[model samples]
Target: MLIVGEIHTALLPHSRPLTPEEARGALALAVGETVVQWARPVPHTASPTLLHGVDCRLPLGPKPGNRHADDAAGGSSVRAVGTVCSRAVLTGGHLLQGSAWTAVAPPQQPRRMPWSYYLARPGTLETIGNFEARRLAEGYLLADGQGKGLARKVRHDGGTALLDAAAIARHSVHDVLSRPVLDQRPPIKTGSTRLRWAAIADPGEGRAVAFRLVGNDRRRMSLVTGLVEPEQIAAAAEDLAVHDWLLSAVAARIALAKIGEDPRHTLRTLRPVVDHLLHLWSAGARTSRDLEFMWDSLERRPGLTRQWTTMTERVRSQIDYGAADLAAKMLDMMEERQKQTGGAGEPHYR
Candidate 1:
């Protein structure tokens, strides 16, 4: 079995973080399932899973404009029939994420199955016609340059089709963000991080997760692991996306600080990094123990927490310097006034 999903991470378009009660109202996407929240490590909330039925052609290539060899290898068109699972998540009660994931399993028979059969599986997708799960996984991780301002390039090749997991995630985000519950004004301006991941389930094999960060535009994460439920993979992906967003968000703030600029303005930009973002860097704190090694591997090299700590200290230093400068200037102004008045009795400097 193979599972593919995309996560869209963005700042909750609000000036303040939502309280636990408020977060509940924000994530109520279904009738029966309740939104789950965790308060200690960090304030986090997750909506109930929602299912979307898709009977579209599975995309054939790794990119929109490129063609996968498998497209021609199969010799005929392939269609996918199944449900894509989507949910909304909030971390630190401030970062909002829209995640959509689905499992792909071979059909009981060669031909397409009834929609009822697929629906019964909920978050699973059944393959129709001819499809290669490995090829589909490769294509998903490839960056096709899809996002704001970038035009999607379409491939007219006969071999492959496109799956709209990102679209499903975006729609979920739009639905919840539109609610009046949100403050609707962002505290800091930053770009969203898009993560598309695919996992191959092999219970006997050892568990492993590998990720390739494709430029700054998108990330492609592929996992080959021992038998694990689809929900577990989705949880690991969600946790990965959240920390990636925090690292990116804080890094952007550090770049924008411009130490050469006025200290006060620098402090203004860095305040949110310290108050809201710093505490959110506890990676793998909520991930499954099976996947903890993935986080460990990443931390050993790029060292996300280390980067965050360095950036945070820089911001704090700038703030301290700015505060001292402002105090000194105020004292100078008072002394100048006294000198101009020759310390006259109109009023004495306190």
Candidate 2:
């Protein structure tokens, strides 16, 4: 079985973090389903699972000798039928995430199954023909408009492809973003982070996860684990996406400042980090034991928190310098005016 998923992370549009009650209302996307909330690690709220039925050709990568052979394109196009799992999450009641993924299993029958059959197995996609976990995962994570050619064609012809997990996640985020509950004033001026992950079933290998920073835009990760469920993998990926977003968002803000720009304006730009984003760097807060290793591996090599601290300190120093510089300039101006006025008496205001 191959489990593939994508996560979209962004700041909640609200001026202030939403309370548990507000988050519940914001995440109410389905009937008879409850949004789960946890308070200890962070004020986290998750919408109930949303499923999208997918019945289209599996996207295969191009093969060396043959032009249209790989699983990404499927020489002639092999269809994969299954339900994609999606959900929205609020972290610290401030960050919002739309996550979707599907587990691909070889179909029990030789042909397309009934919709009821797919619906019965939520979050799983049954493919009719050849299914290669690595190729599918790579194709899904390929940079925008790259490996999507085959997947796009299948969706175009078949009307729906289970492999379009990213689309489901993007739409979920858009739904929350359009709601009136969130204020128009954005908290941080940053772009959203897209993370794609695939967990390939590894019999007796225990659980090990690998993280890769791909194409300078997206983060891709893979998990080779023993018998772990897909939902658990999705949750871990969600957590990773959130923290990774926080880091990337902060870094982008820092990089946007021009050395020659007005210090006050730069201060204004960095203020959001302190006010809204600094307290959001909690890693592995809600990760499951099976996926904790993934977080640990990433933290060790990239040292996410370490980099965050360095950036935070830099921002804080700049803010302090800006404040002091402004104060010194004001004082100098007052002294110059005093000299020009020959130390005149204090003026009275109405």
TM-score of 1: 0.87
Q: Write the per-residue lDDT of candidate 2 for residues 88-168, one digit (tens) a residue.
A: 999988899999888888768887877898888888888787776656655554433332321333434445443556778
Off by over 4 Å in 2: 61-77, 143-162, 259-261, 340-345
Candidate 2: worst 10 consecutive residues by lDDT? 143-152
RMSD after Cα superposition, model 2? 3.4
Kindly list the per-residue Cα lDDT of model 1 for residues 61-103, writing each as its tens digit. 4334556554423433346777888999989889999999999
Candidate 1 local lDDT, residue 166: 86
Best candidate according to lDDT: 1
Question: Where does candidate 1 have its weakest 10-residue lDDT segment?
Answer: 145-154
